[model samples]
Target: MATTWYAPYVAKASGWLSDAVNLADMAQGSTVNLAVTGLSRSGKTVFITSLIHNILSAVHNPNRMPLLNVVASNRLMGTWLEDAGANRLPRFRYQDNIEAMAAGAPLWPAGTDDLREIGIEMRFQPATAPGKLLSEISGTPATITIRIVDYPGEWLLDLPLLAQSYAEWSRATLRLYRRGIRAEAASEFLSFMGQHRHDEPASDEVAKQAHDLYRAFLIKARDAYGLSHLQPGRFLCPGTLADAPFLWFAPIDVPDNTHLAPNTLGALMQERYDTYKREVVARFYEDHFRWFSRQIVLVDVLRALLAGREAFEDQRLALESILQSFRYGSGSLFSKLLWGPHIDRVLFAATKADHVPDVQRDHLAELLRSMAAFPAIEAKSSSARFDVMPIASVISTVEDTQEIDGQRVQVVVGRPVGSDKQAKFFVGTVPIRPPRPDTWNAPFLNVPVFEPPVIDSSPVDGVAHINLDRALEFLVGDRLR
Candidate 1:
């Protein structure tokens, strides 16, 4: 019975688990591998840039993050980056991003395209009385090494696929594509599938063709319709896996209970799908996600609201899929010792709060909470803390009032990139819940890509933001204390 049971365990958890296990780290300092999980263009890069900048700037202008308990209590001594040589992962290009943003003509940093990690050291005075007394006696400054990990957002949608078989996933994807705006975009792939049977002889060429067409449809659906729920999520960013055989397989029509014969198209697909689950998806889950004790899930709620009813519904389904896929819970003292650590705290934020007026920011957060099933997700695990809020990592607009239809409405003024003239945009009233069919009028909002404000590359003049302080407080305050 030695090999009878598949011993479920972690892989490459040595460096990852050290944050939880190493006595040296536990005694002298602690490390929190905070994972930033968000869909593409959800301001993850900007958030990371602003967060690190502000943390370094806290010593200069404590006003930037007054809500962070460490900063509020004046316990934050200073912050600095750790050596990148310590970790084998590629370093996040923070200075290059800052330089790009701080150039004579300002620009926002590019979104994350790879798996990068950065470690920041925060030296602070102990917040707890006993810890403060011990710190005084030992004459050692309390420390926390915050290692932030960022990866392509498309990889996030892959989490749900881990639970689905090739047939099940194909069925669901085809069914969803047949309805709403997706049908038009998927017409080519659907028509291609109409001529091929799943039981046909497996041909590498045919499989690759289908994968290409399906990928094209996914790209079209995303670009033309602003859809974010596409699967095999890494298709767009092939990277080194570009020509991998596992990625050559695509969904085909197959019955739920029908057996895929050996060397059949469906069998190849099923095999490749399983291989992908075991190799690609599982590796990410083990190497990165499992190590995270804290996570920030960023949602561009305003973009969903602006992308029309169908896209909004698509995002809703995506959020629901994520909720159904992952169980976020804190490990008990017993469980942590036995099975390592689990994500204990999560912050689900509605990104780009600057798009809405001050009066509507809470509405933005509430709308995101509803869309993401925040309350229900939180209720499932009382031990874990899941909070939803609206945040703008980089403030790019100024608020003003304008008369619209004989009523004064709040508007935001910003210089949209590639245009010299500043535009005043009045994003329509955002709903706190999904809108009824009749109420969802087309062209609800016009969100423009604004240029970054004049910024000082020096950390002392951290970029302006909204609710970022509170977000930090929720994320790492306990560790500081």
Candidate 2:
């Protein structure tokens, strides 16, 4: 019997047919893929946990989410967790995290470094009268499946590498390391780089040593200096790629427009860099990112501001680089079919909003807006509706007014993490724009990490939050309707 190539074609056609059916089902009762990410310690886990809790709770007690139209209009009929097939992805530990927060002695949940997902099915009455009537006649409410994916924000930093050549990235990264505080932090790594000759024959020992020094510098830059623009993000969160020799490459001071000799240190690093982008970054986009129709990028603005000007600017640059990877637009049918799903809505939220007084919250939002106005980001602003706001996923503080210099100043009172006594915090004022050099020297902003408040385990009561409901409404309100 002669073999035929039609088997592969048949499989591809079948996949397309399946996708068409899925899209049809989505149109009737939408399935939203929501991707959430943030820098280290940016409260990504807490934000996701609270979002799920509030949505599940809102079905029973609409008051819990008054800002969400479905809940506010009493259209949210019910909610339940659908088993995300055991083999697909690791399920998010929603119950375990909720227990930690709602326990007798509330504690913050452990940070997640790996990818996880959860599926929630929401049954709701349609916002439109005709749709509601149709649902009533059928005796079945409309249902939407929301699949949320959580991953480390560090991985997001790797997206920009897809567009740069190894030599270009090396020169750019090396140049960046020599500036301001990065110079101080990268001193050890730079010294190690100086010892090796890029044109010399490749050696595994030298390559691993260089990688270790550079990774160490990246770690210190993030932990000690709060720099956020570090590249090869996987270096910080290796995950399964930890022992992969392909990741043991570091940027070198290769001259622009220079061709590296074959089998040299530069050539080996370049090859591995290309392999990393192909095997690691490209796969991530195809598998996870291309499916997301909505995204939330959590920014720990207060922490960056406190870190000083260089760190703040680095964070702004990092955000600009990361956002470039997202396909942002008013996606048309042709574009959607041809280009895959683009993120229709993106929310750049300043997390830990409760740390600031109410009077300063708008300023925080404005600052984030300014950060997002970078040239690269501004171009994408028109493609998709971009929203910048301040949100506290978990309200860890309470508002209070304090007498300062014989004047009543708004402050927030909260128990600092690891402390039993409550203390009031007033971080002067947040500037609406990036501060000038002189202004930066004024008052140091010292915002403490506050312990999370006690949360009720029941969904009816919901978790305390700031602007979470409003944020949710802006991201997926139209779809819910």
Candidate 3:
């Protein structure tokens, strides 16, 4: 009986050992699993589409990605999207998204709500001595395969659950739901909790009702309040596990250390919660996330700023919490063998840079750095290369100037989605650090969602972008060489 359960883990450990041994082997080629990490509305889909398109375009016109060393040096020989096999996850809808953005009335692609991966193949002339030596032996340009994994940001908020018991998680989560703006969003769930005691007899219907209310609260917090830190993420984006029995439980009012009697309601909920943590959260780490060698944590900083102070602070906490799930540091054979591959490079990007003028873009990036507490994260993981920048997957607005209240102000010009004419929008002065509590006095930003600019269906001109090349260079430049 023990052998059956232990056999899978033994095989997994053996595979990990072999991979660790081959971590430094580049004689054949290299593979980069680029985890496109983000929270709700962080523009993961658009970023992936733009990145793939730009890479393919760079093969024809190197100017598209001049900042990437491989392209600027003119050593990039060819680039193409890899064909997804049956074993692969759902392929990212790159072409469908491109066509939509190029339509008569363009629409931005849908946000990522399911797991998907897209691969890009790059053939490059060897720039380093070792790479040249390997290519000479193979009689061809060296190759690199980049795999990008995209999933719902809601699930990201669940990573911290791996460390908490069901009761501890319940206490912490219930406490959070009662504070500040969340108090109103979770009113129904809290009211429901008041009537249902953990000591009651086990009832699936009652437990399922609690789960329904919690799921409703998450949507309310997200849609109505712009909140991102919701737990049990599968409730929001279940994908294939929509009907899983283990997800039918919700946090009930209970003591942090209390273990209810067997066959009681509390015990049933605890069983489900433990099963969820083991089967879902831990499975994600072992199978997909831990193998990622690089990461890009995208943030919709502009939108978060406009969402109000409570939301802005909530996003900060959520991002910091989500970042804890990643293994950061330079990977060694021993470390990889024990902890799988650590993400040696991390890029934190403020998405939608086109919403701000060039003068304020750097400020936006700086604000994101402070919001994510990048310096502290860097200080802890000294060996990993961490950088933050402002990037627009597709430039949607043009820089212009406008006078407001008899003062000249830098602004961006674009047609808001529903508007018939273009208008200038000034986002006001962006601060380099998190503003004081007293400073969030009023909404200084009056920006609107701008229509996506005309884009080519093919990678001919490569969709107009802001600082994407520079970001990509920081992510995969070393591997290219």
Candidate 4:
């Protein structure tokens, strides 16, 4: 691991300037940077699209979001998207996504692979009397600019690589692959890696072969076996770096104490790994992550549960590892003034709650909390407020009751993807905690993909959801005041 190259220099030169600019903004109005991320196929795109729709819609139809205090108190005056400016990051396609969902035959928006941003201006009356006095004196309503950033959760799994040496990462990754199901899926790649000699001179053909096989294994582990702990996530979703040599290295098996000679395969691989951390991972932290004041980590608990015991546990480990990136603690004012942004609030949300019956939603939330209780994560929990809840950004199912074996069972009814006919799905009760090996003997739950419910084209009606307002209130409610 290497120290971020620019940290010390930036701390010394820009500390006061950055603090003053932030303080000045806070006096007039506040800006909140909200980061939303989740694993592949975790419905992040849908969540963002639905959230924006609901907020903009609440401006005209306050009744749609009664759980949000600003709306319930009749203080939400207006909401609208502002121009993101030219030559900046691309804007999130809010209209295109909503239109797809509202079409005669709705479809889910495409999943995100690149970074995008959207800014919304929320104008509202001040909730407190003194704040109201200030607003009246200024002849303007209080405003908060909410900036939402969307990116792949795969990229997030790479953050921990910043603190790990190539040798350390290789040993850990190799050990993980030898475990229960991963051993079988990763056998081909493992065999190839074992055949190479790390001390030998570097060869492009050999390196490419190793990289290709390892990438193939990652894809199989994710798509076929439902594993979540894959590393160098960009290999799986290589947005713009598809052909770059920076992504051409693979982990090699080597003795812990061995030293590599110059120009050897081991030396070349280590150099590329260091370059990756210094360039790709560090730039992301500096540009995007360092500014986020609030974060939402979405999890597809139901999918993991359905995948079986091995997958459920793997997903848990991946989440616990990912949480390390948010572990900054409260420190001295001087340190805070000089340091980059520290996240004060984090929301670990179990998405697709609509896939299960209402009675089982609490179990979903509890499972997430249990997964997030790793020792390292719990230590950070003391510094920041962590909230765990179940949310469905878009409600695609309606509840119904069915008689089974002389008993009534709650079920969710919706149209499965690619099918014109609607069907009822019943996933067995979700465990409140991770189930032990012996107790996890139930059949895999057959949760079906659901089509989005028909929605009116107007944003005022908004999109139907579950717990989205409560989640929003917890993340940025105080800032709104």
- Each model's TM-score, in the order given? 0.91, 0.90, 0.90, 0.90
Compute the lDDT for candidate 4. Answer: 0.81
Tens digits of per-residue lDDT, candidate 4, 229-341, equal 88987888776566689778889987898887788888888888888888787787777778888989899998888888898898988897777667655552213422576
* Tens digit per residue, CA lDDT, model 1, 1-481: 1311211122142333323332233237778988886777888888888888888898899999988999989989989988887696788888888888999999889766667889999998876654564466456878889999877667767876776788999898888888877999999998998989899999888888999999999988877787878888778656447678898877888887988899998998889899988888777777776787888888898988888888888777777655442454443222331244567888888999998888889999888888866676567653457889999988999999999999999999889999999888777788888888887767343469998889899999788999898998898877887
Clashing pairs in 3: none
**Once superposed on the true structure, which residue ranges of model 3 sit more than 4 Å away at CA?**
1-27, 327-338, 381-383, 442-447
Q: After superposition, how far is residue 423 of candidate 1 from its true place, in Å?
A: 0.5
Model 4: lDDT of residue 425: 86
Which residue pairs show backbone clashes in model 1?
none
Error of model 4, residue 38, in angstroms: 0.9
Looking at candidate 1, the ten consecutive residues that score lowest on lDDT are 1-10
lDDT of 3 by residue, 164-210 (tens): 77788888989889898899999998999889988899999989999
Q: 211 in model 4: Cα distance from truth in Å? A: 0.9
Q: Rate the local accuracy (lDDT) of all candidates.
A: 0.79, 0.81, 0.80, 0.81
TM-score, cand. 4:
0.90
Better of 1 and 4 by lDDT: 4
